[model samples]
Target chain A: MTIKNFLYVNRKAPYGTIYALESLEVVLIGAAFDQDVSLAFLDDGVFQLTKGQNTDGIGVKNFSPTFRALGDYDVTKLYVEAESLAERGLTADDLQEVMYEDEDDDWAEKPSIKIISRAEMADVMAGADVVLSF
Target chain B: MKFGVVVSEGPYTHQAVDSAYLFVKAALDAGHEVPRVFFYHDGVNVSTRLSIPPQDERNIQQNWTALAKGHGIDLVVCIAAAQRRGLLDENEATRQGKDANNIAEGFRISGLGQLIEMGIQTDRLVTFGD
Candidate 1:
């Protein structure tokens, strides 16, 4: 199959709905195809990457740790909408630091989450071959 | 052109699957090919054969099963999501030590990989969900 750019558009908060974790499932599974996979965190989705997500009290499996494992799947490039975070009274510091190993740059560790403007996010959406919205 | 369909909501709770069924039917009527429909999240609930809607109400599972049978479309329910939601196939029920399976006709329990494959294979990938 020809390589395609697949962007997963996340627009929901974690735990309240099943969209967040299920979207993550698709991303991890899609990584096996060797396609260009990237994720966008907008609306309440920015909360998904926040640090210290404990599901112990909720009695649900905490899938937040899987975000860090994306690097191993070669699925990096998490784009967070700056406006969304601002509206939620959050900053980039509030998000968990997701890092990936730079295979081309002597295997150095690099941050995957990019805090971008809404316009840049529009451009990213326009550039993708497939936009899988959640 | 070929279209790929993803239904991410269960029947009745949301109009997603209903709209998806109509969209697929419309696409087929317009002479387009819909090779597969991938059921994810709560959408896997649509494959349960045990659901019995009122006579006045439309049988959603039957509609999809009949449509798929007539069109040779592969109706796939995600195995992981199905297992989580208690909509298992015979093989899955046996493997997981469940009492019984509830998968309806024309639907098979598969993986998320099938969804990705559909995206790669089809000219257009349309998802119907909240």
Candidate 2:
């Protein structure tokens, strides 16, 4: 197997820098190339998938809508770090939409995308053919 | 495997540089070739020779210099990003009439063309940013 896997890790707040935005763009491009793409939100990166992002208050354009488009790009695996979400006081409900939705917020959902610990993040990188972080 | 590293964080404040070094070492240990490392945005700080990290610590600027010398890696600093961040090489420093210089020894100052080239040549492009 060629293992054309791409793991895009996002690690910044939503608005301040172009990191999050550019990362999403790259994911779309990867999917267009027919690669197996997975997105991991870690650290402050979880903010990229956070719900109720109000960009109107900041006078900048909103980017939340673009995230919903990931599914359209065939980006199926969306992993969020449980520790990061706990630190930010965010539950799966606080997120808009994800690869596998967990209504009960248990350890498993649908295909079980793994709401992993920080230690497992390296595994995500280890399996990936390419790891692009923002 | 060939690799391209995207560094977008400043040297002293973030873990991007440290991660880049670790990734490069691991790749080499795994028997991979690093074709090019591209510094963009705030990453251009790696080229600033003025960095003085206290004698007690491993100066990051010097660390990168040593890494490049040891591995013969291609270290590229983005010119636009460098100019915006006040980093100057010998030519730019003279043209701008700066009194002193601080960009590290082993890295080459370049443009986004290097990034595109690396993208085309490398098997994987790993990025570290904040």
Candidate 3:
């Protein structure tokens, strides 16, 4: 089987609808297929990684923790748009530290999320074999 | 190249279905092979046989039906999404004891695995949505 580059574009916030959750479900399942997977957070999607998310009042499952587990699934390349963060008044410090262990460097822990410009992100998107947006 | 199209919005309310239809039409016109068009989320609404649009406007369901009939394109609507949105096929309607089945012709209800398979099988998996 060919190892295709699967780029999942997440542009929706968590909880307004089922897109974010369902998109996450697809990613989790896609990870099992062992594809070259990477996730991009753009527009309102940047909000999905914000820290201190509380779903108690909204009655929805807090899926923010699931983002952390994505690293374990080998989905460690998370690209967050710099413009999107600026528009939302968010910084890297405001987001969760999703990290993965580096297999090449004696298991050294490294951050999975990368803050990137929209142009650079576009290049990454254009490089993908299959782009799945949500 | 084989194209896998995913429509994630409903008919009329959003332009996703219309755009997807046009994209598929253009792909076929260009002599590209579209193996499957997967409908998920509110997109399953496109496969509902009960959608009766105004006479003047273009009928979204019929557009897809014609595409399927004309090109032999496989229209696969996500079963979970279809069930949640009340877009049941004959088998599902019978199993659930519903008197009516609203799944339009040329569309079959399948699992999300079909979408994943499309990702693996096709050269490009383009998605249209809100």
Q: Tell me, by lDDT, which candidate is best.
A: 1
Which pairs clash in the backbone of model 3? none
Q: Per-prediction DockQ scores? A: 0.86, 0.16, 0.58
Model 1: DockQ score: 0.86
Which is superior by DockQ, 2 or 3? 3
Collision pairs in model 2 = B49-B102, B49-B103, B50-B102
Which regions of candidate 1 deviate over 4 angstroms? Answer: none
Candidate 3 ranges beyond 4 A from true positions: B93-100
Considering TM-score, which of the candidate structures 2 and 3 is the better prediction for this target? 3
Candidate 2: tens digits of C-alpha lDDT, residues B1-130? 7888888888878998889988998998999998678887778887877777889976877877887888888899877667767888888889989976667899888766566456556787877875
lDDT of 1 by residue, B14-125 (tens): 9999999999999999999999999998999999999999999999999999999999999999989998899988888898898998999999999999999999999889
Docking quality level of the chain pair in candidate 1? high
* TM-score (chain B only), all candidates: 0.98, 0.93, 0.97
Question: How do the residues B1-130 of candidate 3 rate in per-residue lDDT, one tens digit apiece?
Answer: 7899999999999998999999999998998999899999899999988888999999999999999999999999988788877888989999999999999899999888788889999988889998
How would the docking of model 2 be graded?
incorrect
Candidate 2 wrongly placed segments (more than 4 Å): A1-3, A98-114, A117-122, B10-33, B44-130
Ranking by DockQ: 1, 3, 2
Please give the distance, in angstroms, between residue B10's alpha carbon in candidate 1 and its true position after superposition: 0.9
